[model samples]
Target: MAKALPEFAPLSLKELRSLWKKYRGNEDIERLVLEVQFSRGVINEVDDYFKIIHRTWRQENLGELIAIEKLRLVLVKQHLRQTVLAEIKPAPKGTKPSEPPEPEPALVD
Candidate 1:
């Protein structure tokens, strides 16, 4: 019988962002990347937060770059919507998620 696969917890925002950035290149497309993540439901946040950032706090900034960066950050954070989520627990206790499965031996004649 095959060994049961171990489970893995979802990556945290900080971890996810770091991972995604490590894999993804070109900072220019940050907005687009964030938008995709937001739509994926990977980010689940309430509208009130967005209203506060985009509507209230956002008014404080008017510079082009700051405005753009802030917009993207707010969007990403809002979508992430994780206020008090549990930290992704370490790999199921002793299980190693990185280990590869053994290949089946060739059938004998």
Candidate 2:
């Protein structure tokens, strides 16, 4: 029989953002290089830009970018909702609960 894998918690917003930044930052750096090349007239043709960017200039990239952005918005909304709920239902004050009074002794026969 296969062993069961341990359950893992979902990634927090901070973790997700860190991961996104680590990946997207590299892509952004590459894109900036391309942008500079274009500005300096180093890349004259669309084909050259595509070749340098290591992509075939497909519209799929734009669609994926939009989808990822939309997912980010949803994550933000959920986080905000959870925050509001937590604030709205704050925990009870830190007071020691009083003990119940001792039961009265049974009446003598």
- Scored by lDDT, the top model is 1
Candidate 1 residue-wise lDDT, 27-99, digit = tens:
6555554654454343233332344455544577643457645666765554344433424222233432234
Residue ranges of candidate 2 with Cα displaced over 4 Å: 1-64, 88-109
Candidate 1: stretches off by over 4 Å = 1-10, 26-33, 36-46, 49-81, 86-109
Model 1 lDDT at residue 14: 61
Provide the global lDDT of candidate 1 against the true structure. Answer: 0.45
Cα RMSD of predicted structure 2 = 27.8
For each candidate, what is the lDDT? 0.45, 0.38
- lDDT by residue for model 2 (1-109), tens: 9998785443433443444455665777546544533332321232233333333224345334564445446545543443353222222345222322232222111
